[model samples]
Target chain A: MSNVSATLPRKARVPIFVVLVLVGISIAYPILYLAFTAFRTRADYLGNPFGLPSELTLQNFISVWNNYGIGRALLNTVIVVAVGLTVQLLVAGLAGFALARYPVPGARYISGALVSVMLIPSQVLIIPIYLLLSRIGLVGSLPGLILVYVATGLPFATFFLIVTYRSLDTSVLEAARVDGAGFWRTFLSVASPMAIPGLATLLVLQFIAMWNELLFAYILLPNDQLRLITPALAQIGGRFTNDQPFVAVGLILTALPPLLLLSFAAKYVMSGLGASFGR
Target chain B: MTSPVLAAPVASASAGATGARPPGRARWRTSERLVGIAAVAPAVVLVLGFMVYPVCYAIWISFNKTNGLSFDYVGLDNYTKLLADPLLHKVFLTNLIFLISVPLVILAALVCSVLLYERIRGWRFFRVLFFVPNVLSTAVIGLMFKSLFSYRGPINAVLAQFGIPPVDFFAGAGSAIFVIIIALVWSGFGYQTIILLSGLSAINPEIFEAATVDGAGWWKRLWYITLPNIRGVLALVSILNVLYTFTALFGFIFVMTAGGPGYDTTTLDYLIYTLAFSSTRLGEGAALAVMVFLLIGGLTALQLRVFRVSEEN
Candidate 1:
């Protein structure tokens, strides 16, 4: 695959490579700029915004963590994502498995309903979800936000896993059933084990999603202390216009988890993208 | 019904003794049904309780006037007010302007994907690098752009070297929308490229070889062969980008411009937030939400029709 440029003459390849490299730099430069700005003092950044930092400093990171309440936000986000991902996976996984394999009553309708739910623009749901959460006394709480994430996330997650489960070797599931393994037993001991790759893909996709979700997290968790990392970054960025480096630190912190996940689980993340669009 | 593995086991079980109904088969069927219901119950319940219920409530709220807590049935009053509201019209226009980014993103993605399809050196690295922005939170991307395009930001610094004075990228509605569109394209094209690359990979290499033998140059091959082959994927990508532009732009607008320069860059999604939460006009916001929802549905359906017609060719 590496040398598949047969149609391109040797001379043309250089310009193509050059254009790609320039595009690559253009895509990467903003992020790289953020990192460089984050490490510099405010004065250094203001004086030389485009150049490398004259002197490295941890002041921005420390101040953002301490004074900007990013520490609390980080902890809050972890709790939401951790609790949210687990419940989302459990609900989506079981439903996906059952719908795919079992002769569930109304399975087609249910599947169709889930797909339609994905079509509903979430903006329409926000006002009412906020109202409902408040009515249920979960509004402005992490648990309420978690519920929103799971609810909004279920349609796609369940759909993705259904595709995953359907592609699993049915003979393995049949063997488990023949051994008298019930649904739960087979799910835990046989089917899910074989579905680890699919589950991992869903997990990575959902992890990044929940980690980066802004609107619901911002709307549901109005308390400053309860702000998720993304919303916290937004608030800090909005509040401190003069302190670019400090805000850059917040952006870096907000982006770090997903970027790390991308680095380590790029395959799973990229694979999940196709599943998302049902391609 | 289509599962041979499932049917095979059941057939063997029934054939073991008399052709009469298997005694435990009925019990097992009931158990299986029970298990299926149980497995799917949590998802069904949550979706119903949260998604379905809120949408219904939003429909109700859209017809009546309410803040957030209480509602008095005003019966189309909210919808009437929004219909007459100039801000809604302006915001709708803003959204339409944002739609321009979709084609821009697709064009960039097409070029990159075509180049990458050749399997040039470092294609893999470039693929991943391009997708990095897609993984980052919108808030991060928005803020990164905010800083990058700020009057005193690096963009201005670089411009100063060219003797072009600093430009306040966010001061006016025109400049602000331009900045937002640029940010949208910058962040969006990478993912679309990845999708297009996958679509490209699905095309037979033999087709390209045959085209090469037929004296088709690279651009000619791309124009005649590559473009037609990926039309379906391009359609899919276009629809996704359209939906994204309409629905998923709140965070970007929120952090980047906050719909700034006096409602110039306020997208429909962002306006919904401001109306419902900031201004406490929940009824009108809900009405706007419904309108946006319908608009998106209609636009998506229209695009599907257009693309389907083209695809048939």
Candidate 2:
């Protein structure tokens, strides 16, 4: 170990290692505190914020689930994420592929317009969306929330996909055309397979964005049945103001799905997010 | 999207190269156009319905007074009232407070990315640890950090161990801004670091190896080789980071401090939310929203122009 460390400069190594250790602690501290507080009794937490539990208990998770209906909320969240991502990928993919491959008139205008739409803050658009959704009786529906999610997620998705598509080798696309493949054939067989990493990356991003979306979900879904996890968790916390453990559980429940999704697909997400920045 | 240059060649290639055109080629063209339009129509219509038309409506709202669902065309009244609103000015400063985190967080992410790029052991584990906060919901993060930063909370507890006074963390404009910045930087830097790490990775190794061979140390190599190569990524990340951090509602601000001890951390996004929901001044809120939209749009456009120049190189 000493011999291995000798290749690196000692002066540089010590500070770098120390900085890394500090960072690692800082990042881990909150997560550990979260777990610790959730398990501890209220008195225990008050006494020692960082101490181990005297007696480990499942009461917090249990009470949180039964009282807050996290199970139903979880189901609702899965639907939103699944449906939202599917619609987003479909719309974003078609738009991206068309913008990349076709020579439709006003194509540049459309592409530029879509990219510009990305800059419009959701706060500016949320009221109008709510009004429109109300008019169409979509304000309280799962499908309605999914529709809004797709729209909001579209701009970045299309932009990222378009960039990735353009970077793909054109000769491969040319070969598909020469073999008498149509647009759909070329997209599926030639373009998409090669763009898997990029698409996977987009999928992960869109999922996280849609999953964590609060404003629209809060405004649109009034009924508990339709409420997605984010706003649902907020609602849960509001109901049990005194239940610190319940609030803790709500936080964990809200956080766990995305944490699982990201940890499972960390590499792809990192690549996808980094790709648009040309990483 | 394919550039116009690429598009023209592709269209002609389809039409001219297949011996004489097939009989149904015209039909194919029409079908292709229809398919293309159909593909892009939903997205365009959604944006038009949600953003474009509504933004125009909001501008008109700024000129009128609306009570809930009722509209009364009192031209310039709402705008004038908004101008006189002291809270609006506070909201503006609050947004500025959020913006203060952008440079600080970006610097942290840059340093973290550089460290990880050194090919350190357990780099993946560190990356995940840093990124865990980002994956969590902003509200939940807000809740947890509120506890952590509370008066008798762990942070203050730690401070007490050092014999420092328990500062009123969320008590004032400056300290409230400071806490929010720390939270924003903690939760935010992971994504930026990930972007920077990839950017660092994308830098060609040969450039650095060349620098090393020329007796350039790590700092010299980073300055001359790594930094220049990742200029495009750096520009892109910074633009996105600034936009995102600027628009963030200061969720922790909302849950923890409620934009107070006074209106210290009430950012534009939160102000709009509070105005609409709490104050029920929908017209003024719409105006504020429009102003924020325009400001972000202009800045983003400028950023794109700057980044595009680097990308071209």
Candidate 3:
């Protein structure tokens, strides 16, 4: 092992190995550029695209937040995520509980249909949904976007939670029942404890998806104020074609929320969510 | 209350199998059914009304020839026209490019996960750092990368540092494809790495310990032990990644190149968006949508079958 490590020749010697590393760096360069330019100034950016910023400044970050008003976009994203994930979790949880604990006729059929929904693109149904929402005067509202988010989120969440609830030992529920617990009581006390990891995983995954969604939100919400971070950031491109630093800071900020949530939720997301689909 | 409504029918079905429905049992079942329906009715109604109903309406509209909203049934003409467009063929080819990128993503993800999994220090920080891009919305990432790869963008700047000539990543077709590839790889690999690492972490430590005790080194342990243990997860992640790649968002291409440098990045998703919204060829877009759905469904089914075959071993 020591010999193999030593003979590795301090950074690849073979021609093919050298070529592969070069290719890897080539693939990686743009990403590195994004990181590097975050600190650059407009003059430096235009004059020398790849050189280190002549002078470091936090001015771009401030401009991205204050001038571009991404701070509000970030707040709106939080509101959307909080409401969307809560509604999704509650609705899916109740449905999954019924399917798992109660005798729901055609449960298999309902589950199958929901799973099938996962296969279809949002494009096919989004237009009609738009027209329907327009009829009810929800074309440009935060609540309207939340409604669409919940609808889109339901199928996968239900499928996931049902599998999770079913896989738990039923004896725990029976024990609570023997101790005079009713259905909701047993569920709240017993099943939910064992299912927290699954619930957390779903929340993280769905939150990221909702937070990152652009198409429906862009189409459904016409007002710039109601626009989520995605469409908002997209609009920045219209006015500033050459402002690379602004784009860099916006990209970094936009990436922050999901990265933070995913980092914390990584352990649960893997073990809990991955386990449900194993069969 | 919802449970009783939803469960009644199933309970009754199970009871019917025993062939004795007593009066009290029937009354209780009736109430239970009502409760159960109430519990699940919200989600069911939403799915039916929003998802199923919209799809039905859209499919119906595709058969007709109208503006975004009007009434005219020009049956099959739109479909015929859509089939004849040379651009439709381009869209199919673009979709093939989308399909081709998936393996590259999976291979990169597997490599990154293994490298990061070597009981190394600062594992958590590196994992988070790598995954940072996955959380960024595709539109933002797309927008940022568009600038980054443009003629005066930092990518060209960096090449100059190594005494190399500046390359116009957006000007030429090959370089344009490279830009899209970079964004696709940049945005995707992080998520897969996290998932793959989880799979790696879940392998029973005892298995590795056993391999080590038998004098299995890193390569031998990885080849003979780690790979086999995470096979199911590897299949699942690959399937998920393939589906994600197939549905490459219009947002990225729209922001980055706009399928530009002369239509170099016109994947099926981008083409479908254009056909529906831009070209007003709703029927063709619908056809394209159906094609994407079928392709993803076929791949997912294949994945499941492969998974099952491996499990039997």
Q: Considering every candidate listed, which one attains the maximal TM-score?
A: 1
**Alpha-carbon runs more than 4 Å astray in model 1:** A1-3, B1-28
Classify candidate 3 by CAPRI docking class: acceptable
Model 1 B-chain TM: 0.89
Candidate 1 residue-wise lDDT, A20-67, digit = tens: 999999988899889889999999999989988889999888888879
Question: Highest DockQ, which number?
Answer: 1
lDDT tens digits, residue span B101-195, model 2:
88888889888988878766677788887888877777777777766776656787788879998777777778777777788888888888988
- Candidate number that wins on lDDT, 2 or 3: 2
Q: How close is every model to the real structure, measured as TM-score?
A: 0.94, 0.85, 0.82
Supply the TM-score of chain A against the true chain A for every candidate structure. 0.96, 0.90, 0.86
| TM-score (C-alpha) between model 1 and the true structure | 0.94
The candidates' DockQ values read: 0.57, 0.38, 0.35
Q: What is the C-alpha RMSD of each candidate to the true structure, in Å?
A: 5.3, 5.4, 5.6
Candidate 2, residues A1-279, lDDT tens digits: the string is 112222347677767777878998998778777766677666666665555667666788887778667788889889888878888887788778876765444556666677677767778876666666777889889888888787777778887887777778878877777788887898888999998988988888777777777878887898877777888776655565445556667777778778888889988766676544421
Candidate 1 vs candidate 2: the DockQ winner is 1
In model 2 chain A, which range of ten residues has the least summed lDDT?
A: A1-10
Docking class of 2: acceptable
For candidate 3, write residues A1-279 as lDDT tens digits: 112222123343343244334434654455566766777888887887766668888889898888877888888878988998898888888788766665455566667778888666786666667767877989888888898889887888888888888778877765665687655776677888898878888877787788888888778887877777887777776467678788877776776677677677767644544533421
lDDT, residue A102, candidate 2: 55
- Tell me the whole-model lDDT of each prediction, alpha carbons only: 0.86, 0.73, 0.71
The candidate scoring highest on lDDT is 1
Ranked by DockQ, the better of candidates 1 and 3 is: 1
